[model samples]
Target: MKRLIATFVTAFLTCAAPVTAAELGDDGLHKTDWMRDTFKDLPEDLAEANAEGKRLLLIMEQRGCIYCDKMHAEVFPDPKVRQAIEENYFVVQLNLHGDIEITDFDGETLSEKAAARKWGILFTPTMIFLPEEVPEGATAAQAAVATMPGAFGKGTTFDLLTWVAEQRYLTDPEEDFQRYHARMIVERNNGNTE
Candidate 1:
């Protein structure tokens, strides 16, 4: 009985504790185990993500961006957020000024920087969540179900991940993210954000 209690306590603490992240890369980007080192082809990546039953996530970050640093150091390291990304997302990281070539879903191939410009990604730490079924001839940006720009708190980030993973944007179009987030805030705080 004592051993049983110890095991239960260990499980509880493991689930409750925040996760510490690894050192950032020379590019100043977080190298998480969940991130996929893919060929950067949107169509192929989407197909692979679907095969693995995961949502395709394109995250844009730049070198020495403090916002990206904050997300890596604080937001992404949260156990819930980390678990959400690892379990539900097939993350592809794109450097804002990287020279690596990328192939868009629309069949347009360009450098990472060019694609960022084309997609109108003006902020570091922008996370673009794609729908399972992307429309033919649509760019990745055009086919994104939701876009998260800038660093956010752990709750908001986790909620957004849940919202996208659950495909709330499609199933309930009337309930926009703002409304969903409001409802989520109430629920998360037990109806009292104060």
Candidate 2:
């Protein structure tokens, strides 16, 4: 009887626990199973993503960044958002202040910090979505289709992922990300019990 009660208590605790978040690495960055471990070469990364039929997504973050922490804790752990990212994007994490070397698509080699500067990344958790094919002599900043500069809710994050994955920015010029997001929000609310 005691064993049964203990087992029930454990199960209740487990069921009531919050969604599991990513673990922090030694670099103080959150590590996710969907993120790819790569050599940080932009062209090679894009090629690999293309080979796998996925878009290349460069995620810029820094240690001790609150917004980045929020994203890793709340938004990324959402099942739909996680699935969208895993299925559509080859995510490569770049530390905004790290010393690790990175090779850009334009043949410029620089440290992660320098690359962030080169890309004009002014915010932590900047997400740069790239096209499958880059124009000759184009840097990553010049080639990016969309850039998300801050942490957002799961809905916005998921919409951005979906927009980029579906290539809506290229095909649906009349409807921008904001418009699409607004429509999605209304549609979602339509189904809400409230």
Candidate 3:
């Protein structure tokens, strides 16, 4: 009975503790086990994400952006946030100034920087959440269900990801992201966070 109680305590603590994160890559990006290293093709990545039962997430960041640093160091390291991303999303990182080739959902191929410009991504640490079924000839930015610009606190970030994963944007279009996040904040303060 003592051992059983100890096991229960351990399990609870493990579940309650914040998750540690992976090391930063040489590219100055946090490298998680869940991030995919692909050819930067949106359609192919979408197909792969679908096959893995995950949503395709495109995250843009620069090498020296402090907001990116904050996200990798603070927000993403939270266990609940990390778990939500790892379990429900296949992330692909894009360097804001990189010259690497990227194929867009609309079949346009361009460098990472060019794509960023085309997509009107003017901020570092922008997270673009794509819908499962993108219409033909739509650009990735055009097909995105939601876009998170700049770094946010852990709670907001987690709630945004959760909203996207649950497809709340589609079903609760009237609620919107702001309303959902506002409700989440209230719920958290009320002790039902999650």
* Best model number under lDDT: 2
In what order do the candidates fall by TM-score, top score first?
A: 2, 1, 3
* Least accurate 10 contiguous residues by lDDT in model 2: 15-24
| TM value for model 1 | 0.87
Cα lDDT of all candidates, in order?
A: 0.91, 0.93, 0.91
Once model 1 is optimally superposed onto the true structure by TM-score, how far is the C-alpha of residue 171 displaced, in angstroms?
Answer: 1.3
Error of 3 at 39 (Å): 0.7
Please write out the lDDT profile of model 2 over residues 77-189, one tens digit for every residue.
89999899988999999999999999998999999999998889999999999999999889998999999999999999999999999999989999999999988898899
lDDT of 1 at 82: 92
> In model 2, what are the clashing residue pairs, if there are any?
none
lDDT of model 3 at position 98: 91
| Runs off by more than 4 Å, candidate 2 | 1-20, 191-194
lDDT digits (tens) for residues 100-171 of candidate 3: 899999999999999999999999999999988999999999999999999999999999999999999889
